[model samples]
Target: MRLIFTLLLATSLSVTGNARIFYLAPGGSDNNAGTIASPWYSLNRAWSVVSAGDTIYLRGGTYAYTQQTFGYMVGKNGTSANRITIKNYPGETPVLSKGTGYTNNNEHWRGGCYLDGDYITIKGLHFAGYTQADNFVWSGLFINSSNNVIVELCQFYNNGGGLILEGASTNNLFLNCDAYNNRDPNTGYGNADGISMKFISAGSTNTVRGCRAWENSDDGFDFFDNNGYVLVENCWAWRNGFIPYTTSQGGNGEGFKLGSTNSFPSTVLRKLTNCIAFKNRQSGIHQQESQCLTQLYNNTVWDNGWDGVNFHYLNLPHTFINNLSFDNDIAQVQVSGNSTNTTNSAGTGTNDGGWTVNVTAADFITLDTTGISGARGADGSLPVINFLRLASGSDLVDAGTNVGIGFNGTAPDKGAFEAGGAAPPPANQPPVANAGTDRTITLPTNTVTLNGSGSD
Candidate 1:
């Protein structure tokens, strides 16, 4: 009997020592234990209680706040082996909103949540209704000075800005997120971008992948004065620089503002891969005065207000390959300085050399943009759409110089969506499953548990 009691106690201690799970809900109380049945009331309570390797699951409901500066500031750090996770309860959406009665200041920045912690993962939460009366620079979530953070499967809308990463934030990832409908009324719809990563030092290596941004007042994705190596992959941006539900245009309006004018030249390093930009008010991809070498590969830009790609800042050693630029109001690609421009659409750079190809409406399967803003998949991936897919018999198929990235057929196609390669597959495919390793059990432990968590 004593041996059994000791074993049970040891098991309990081991479980608690390794990791813990907490719960948060709209109607919970700080005084109560943070169990699934009796959760905490606020994110602040969770921040005060959680530790490394802990997870806090927020329940479905609107968590309204009236804070003037920030609703919640998460400052706890986690280790590389075990990250602190804040996620919504499965199958439910938890929304964080800035309620009425919050003071608005144009000079100050307001945020619904501020993440200043390292090695954290925040997923499947919605940040909405965080706007000010004036043209205050606000964000649904602000990541400041954080490292090794992953913010995935989140939504940010109707805020002053969607998400902003700044101030020494390094090695962060924003994956499969959406930002839309963010406008600043007082600034004549200026200063509200879908996502902006600015003011970080070089070598930060922040990345954004599989994300979508649309209908923001300012640029879709802005890397303004960020002296870091930033990457944007498999992303889409459209209809930015216009007010939501209206034709009125505002702000700089570039779909992907790679970099703005920098006081210190050649400070930014950026790479774009498999991205699509369309219908923005300004240039599709604009690099203004960023004299650093940038890489543009397998990107598609069409029907933008200004040039498809305006890399006019005299940056040396830029690389433009396997890109498609079509139907912009200005030139297809307005570039200067030195670049390795090859395997792209005709007339892309000063010394363009590639297989000749012309893009027209007949070259694409569809250009309707109907399902661009549709619902995401169940696993929080972007919806697969037919927009901008190369037609079956287009000359662009297998016509690109391989830049070592993965490709199908003899060579990669010259656009964001590869002809029969990386183009999104049809919906409703069966999810693949995986069972964990096999284990042997003795007579005392005849029953053994298997881990299936790694299955998709």
Candidate 2:
């Protein structure tokens, strides 16, 4: 369904008379009036004369891109109040495809669905299969637009990377998007990622809220080399830096990697709250650059290969409040290089350098969240999962030092979940069950049988 969003962004966009609504469908003709009954044949035709305050609705269909001449939803500006919206029609999907033989030159050659516009809204779209090749060139969606753009309810999978919003991209909002299965075939310089919004312009910031990134070849969310502050809230990342789709070896993986590995550190601050990072190949959350200030609040992380949440290289102090870490291979907090860890809790003993609470996994209702994605509420907010919810009467509840945020009980909880925070109102969802019983399964046609691993 189309969302009723307010346009309160601050920017300069030309006043182009009044708003217009254009329509595009698979079977539309260029000669049509761009109306619902007679939509335009291509996005190029609809956006050719589109102005500020105009809205373009893409009808449900598979819009495939060609390498010979790629398609771009490019250079259509909209104002703050009356923004331009290019979105899928209500209750429909617009699947954008990078057709067979997707090459590496889309980043340089510009041969795919490219997004380069300001103050535009893109929603309820899926992109597929823009992979292979190296040099970190092409991606499913290339975004280098100006300001106040909103990318929502979009899915990018099996691509080189999901989206790259860089190069002076500012004040962009990414909400409820999922990026997975992005891989680089070139092992020499593998950097296939999910959605990276680094290198943002000075005095411009980007915010990612209610996003899910998982199972990409590289890091799930990369905000490296950014000069502006990046705020992330209520997001999740898991199984990154490995091919979750094909179960293959992925590139340099980290769940949420803040700052850059380059010589120069990021020149801005980063804030994260109510996020979860689990099951990633590398550290669940890591900051490469020591100079950048980081603020972490009410985050939950577990079962990662390295440290659940690490900031060992920090010489400058940071804010770490009410974050939780458990079941990671490395120590709860790595104490190195003038570190000052805060009152965060790790299941293991938290006595390294500045650790405080030694909260254990038993304090949580459940330790796993294999089925926690997209189960929040009708609006797709943070899920109230049995996985990692703080147990009643546990020391973690109300044991956290106050961070000026609201509390459900007497005080704030140590982790993301609060004891008395109400769950989402009831909704109509199909029942689901997961189990891992030892059994043999045989394909009916192939007559191939395999044994179960007896795990869930």
Candidate 3:
């Protein structure tokens, strides 16, 4: 009995200790040595060898290619816990690309890490572009699968495209990523969107948090032909252009652009919170021909070339809450065409001749005493507005409706940030370490292990 029990326990331990690690160097080997000293030469080689629960570490160094065309076509799939992770080794950014001197006009030569598998985690790498014109053809990371994937703390610059999450990718997240400086030679336009969710059929919930999109030739974040729930919170976009325009279409260049062509069970529940948009040539947030419940709260829209918020063909049941607008050339909120009554509250508009509170139907605007003072109604009660901006020394200093959403335990100041109280500092920055020299593509004799020991 003792001998049999010992053998069974050993077998269980073997199964539990099956975590493997692969390393990728600037110039390395793909042999199954499983040592940082002996690493894989290419990303595809690592992908081929890693199992469902394996992690491939890319060591610090610019893994540049002499050839103009170098791309990684992934072939492996992973589960939720055993998902394959391609992350920085420990100390530096793993630069992944073909070569530097290549011109952008090579249409056939496409490159960048292409992902088709599910449950993948890519972190802490810099994806650089080949040529200015090539920015339209290549992408930093292309994701097609779904379920518990994370793309965090990556830098994508001058690429043909940023991150593309398509093909029913649900429960995926893009956190703390940056995309800028992508240019296209064909249209004299660039494809430098921070993130784009296109052609999604299923109802996926994708959240973009603490990301920055700037100076992209197109809109900062574009949701094209998608029918999914998207939440963009605490992100920044500046100096981008929309379609049909060239130079910095300005004013954060249409912070959020939504268009649903087919309208079959149209995209629903788009929310923007705690964001700031300023100094773009166009409106801060623009929606066109989409019947979705859009909500904008605790955001600051200022100094845009046009209106602060512009909408056309936007259906009813939209909520604009607690936003501050100032110094825009047009109205704070501009709505034309036939549309249902959207709620507006707790917003302050100033410095423009346009109405501080402008609406197609005046009866729909309601100011609530729960927020700071602004527009008064004939009944001597405050109309309930969607967004409320607190004036200096105003009673709204601590007066706000506790909606119990997105509150960070501060006193719930009247506006986005905790007034008089410090705004909660941005989330802790990701650990700074080199990502290039960390991953070595080597097959391990031992199986990969999955653990849930860390703090949740």
Candidate 4:
């Protein structure tokens, strides 16, 4: 009977073709057919029929994971040509929430969607409002052993962890995602961060591009015991450790905690380029105990409670080029060892200026967020705001030297925002009909989900 059923399934697929899309809706029933008019209520029901080269479309509505269990697609593998995609339906936002009583005791239960599949893509969905279950570090999206995965344009709000990439997950890309207000009361063992990639071996290479992480309880971006190469670029981390929404306190609240809770080499070789770390409670851009080829280029650290750029006890030939800092506690840029650095200036020369001409916040147009931190440009890059722009007559306008990256006037602008660089062209949008690398499905497999939006 099982063989007959398998043959029937293959024959049905042959009649349709390869590839499909499944739809889910809040008002739908689990027994309903996974179709547009008759959508499946549970992601598990959609998973029962979905295969490689499939898309899962979740319609616009609130999915209460507590009332109805959270959705997850795990332990499935998709071939390169037929990657599984789970995303928001076109032109609508699918909100996933875990209200109170997800657990009676208030322990973290790894809420939201847990993904353990490889060659998958998750995009354009939002997760929020889950009570910690068993205090076991939960996340809106958890990816474990998932290689070649792409998670972009999703969001996390008020969850324990926004995104957790863990356990031998390799060659994944997370782009254009935002996280805020995620916290766990676990105190010293803080279980909250905008994003975390932990316990990953060197073989796991990941990249986060054009993302924003703020107001998280713990660090904005954290890597705990990741001996891997994770490149983070054009990202923002700010206003952490203090809840701007409420008068509550936050966790460590560092902007980018490159490596923590272990030795240095594990965190070395990770590259942070063209990133911004500001207004965090701790050091803006910090790394400790490293002796390897760690790279920091074209980054901006400002208004952090501690050192704007802190590289401590490192005997490595690290590179810091064209980075700027100001308004830090001890000093602007604090490094324990001499590094191969240049064009890095900070407050009191203890910053990136490194005994050169020291500049203050007076060099900027406005030290406040008058125009910056608004909407991004068409290309999804940082918006062109004068909030931190160098004045025409300011010394920082062209003080930076060429380091083989794009610049406006003479050199790169001193900080994350370039002085007058044009916004990059808009990237490819999703719900593609047909093309190479574009997601598509036939009439028989019309159920579909949105794919990720690409960023740099």
Candidate 5:
């Protein structure tokens, strides 16, 4: 009887042919009907009926009332112009999971929905309540043996192993998805990593952008055991425990953790830009392993429990330019263990722990031309740092070395701010409060200029 039903569904789908649209609702029909009123009940029914260039739209509701398994293989050489699209209707949230109150020993009872295809797009769906410690029971959306796919604008909350992209899945993009509050009922160790892209094979060129991961028990985002080019931009991670655990041996909970040693001979290059890390329990940002280039620019790291930028391991070269670190208890840049070949400089800072250089009038125009703005000391006033300024009676009007790093523009400036600084003024103009007066402390070599920015 089941075989006959499958054949009938396949035959109906083949008959309808190109560009068909089907709907899935609770306990609906599966006789190849495409209307929401007379929709198909299960994804399997829709899959059996959907052909190339077809779309399967799921209604906004809970599905799989019973413990049922639905495995759909996407990709199948679907073209970018005529690809298969599985999406939820606009302004609706659909959930796919194993039936409620059904717990299995292998953890496979939590909505084992697997995708094993390529060139497919799944968007705007919410997957939850799934639990899987090992690889058996997976998350709401498990993608294996797929490529050239995109999952965007979806929410994965309160599920086990939130979202897993494994099994040689390459060239996939996860955009603006949320994974949080997922817990493992069995071992009590689960991760709400907005997403975990595990490539057993070589998976390259993946992008994760505009995502928010907060308050998750595990790292907000983690990538391991793969040789891929990943770019994480404009993402925010706060209050997440053990954030970005790259590896067990040399992994520190950080706002952005990149590169790992889980798989030897697997080189990965990650680029992180325009991000902020503050008040995290661990380091604001961590980079380990060998030959991993962490280019951090135009970022703000302040008030972290540990060092603002922590680099460990060996041969991990970091290019840090034009970043601000203020009031961190530890050194702004902490290089420990056997790590080598690191370059650190001040692009900007209010209360930083480093060599204090004065910027003077002569050096100001020169340094400003080079893009290094004069230092606004603790007193909210500009100091001087130029070579000739020091030769004259000027305190720091000219007492800086011309051998420092240059800015993005022509010439070089002294202190944190270049000619055109990265930190912008706060929106919505408001009145400034004065803290009274400024006190200057004279040091042996260079005088310490105290500003309203407080202690570092």
Candidate 6:
């Protein structure tokens, strides 16, 4: 009987030991047990007690901070099977704000949340009012050295910058997020971006999907000095590089700044697909000295202050397919790279090697810029709009080569959206393995790197 009791107890403990739910409220106390009714006060308290499979639900309210460096820091690790989740309570909103009096030294930076945890998920939180007038800048959510972290449905506004992932962060996903109105007065509205993924380690991959960035001081999305593969899909950026409601010039207002460094030797391939960038001060998509391979597919850019698509670099290898660029201040596509171009629509490009069709206002249902920055759907998807979708019988339909991504008609459509069909499933194929090339190792060498890019 004693053995039977021990066995049953062990089974029960094994089933329930790993997972626990903690609650955080703006008015709660840390001395409580973190229950739903008696919740903890701060994210710091939750971070101190959470383990793998543990969840911290933040109740609705303002969580203000005055710290010079980090308002709240998370340095925990969860497993692959069980992730640590810090999310808003269902049907409620949690806002994280920095104190108005927050000021640090001229050399120091500040962040509302510093997340360095692995395998964590943060969802449905709003980070706002994180501005500082000091010489340094601030980030709403700063993620560093973290792997497999997921940040979804978050909004960042009125801050120095938005979400920034850097320094060896790998495989992190930012989904259904919005970053706008982020300006840095210290640099004359420079050095602030909606999403900045910089200095990531090589051989790692990060994804940003279904996000929006607008009216930020700097670029909408800046991938500066990253050596990893970044996949950006279904995102939008507009009206950056200018102060809101004013003509004051902001920072370098490129919509998507795809990397800047030419020093890294890794095969860093950045891919952007199904994205829209418009009305920026600079080029919509600028490949700023990223000598690595970049793949741009099914993107749309219009009404930019400079070239719509700028890819002038040192004859770097790039791939542009089914892209549409029109109505910019300067040329449509500025290409100096040795890129594979196919079935694109551009006006006045320096290299018109791949120009196929001419896209005009007649090709779209509505050129009116209305409701582009409206509210998102309940499921946090992008706002459905007819701003740039291809009209019926437009030449852009079925005018693209198959690039492995799914298409609707006999071939893929030219721009970001297919003209007349539901979205298709991903390409179905057999599993193929690629172990890179054969390498000859010296006697003293202990290891060698293998290539997996050929694998699908």
What does candidate 6's lDDT look like per residue over 24-110, in tens digits? 888888899999999987787788888988888999999775554434555689888788889999989999886766645322255
lDDT of 2 by residue, 360-390 (tens): 7779887766576554455556555677788
The alpha-carbon root-mean-square deviation between model 3 and the true structure, to one decimal in Å, is 11.2
Clashes of 6: 0
| lDDT of prediction 4 | 0.72
Write down the TM-score of every candidate: 0.87, 0.83, 0.72, 0.83, 0.63, 0.86
lDDT at 414, model 5: 26
Q: Pick the candidate with the highest lDDT.
A: 6
User: What's the C-alpha lDDT at position 238 in model 4?
Assistant: 87
Number of the top-ranking candidate, with TM-score as the measure: 1
Each prediction's number of clashing residue pairs: 0, 0, 64, 15, 31, 0
Rank by TM-score, highest first: 1, 6, 4, 2, 3, 5
Q: Write the per-residue lDDT of candidate 3 for residues 1-456, one digit (tens) a residue.
A: 111111112333422347688888887866646468888767777766787777888888887754432345455778865777889997677888756564333423344566767778888888876433432456666677566788888877776666777777788888877776654545455444557777776467888876766666666777776677788886666566633235534223565665453453233457787675655556677764555766676666655667676754534445555555555666576653333222232234532223234221121122232332233232222223343334445443444445455453344543444444454344444433322223333343343332222111
RMSD of 1: 6.1
Model 5 deviation from native, Cα RMSD in Å: 20.0
Compose the digit string of candidate 1's lDDT tens values, residues 125-205.
999888846546778888888999999999999998899999888999999999999988887888899988987877678
Residue 395 CA displacement from its true place in model 4, Å: 2.3
Tell me the alpha-carbon RMSD of every candidate.
6.1, 13.9, 11.2, 8.3, 20.0, 11.9
Q: State model 1's lDDT.
A: 0.80
* lDDT at residue 116 of model 5 (Cα atoms): 70
lDDT of each: 0.80, 0.73, 0.59, 0.72, 0.53, 0.82
- The list of candidate 3 runs beyond 4 A from truth reads 1-15, 31-34, 66-70, 100-110, 130-136, 242-252, 264-267, 336-396, 406-411, 420-456
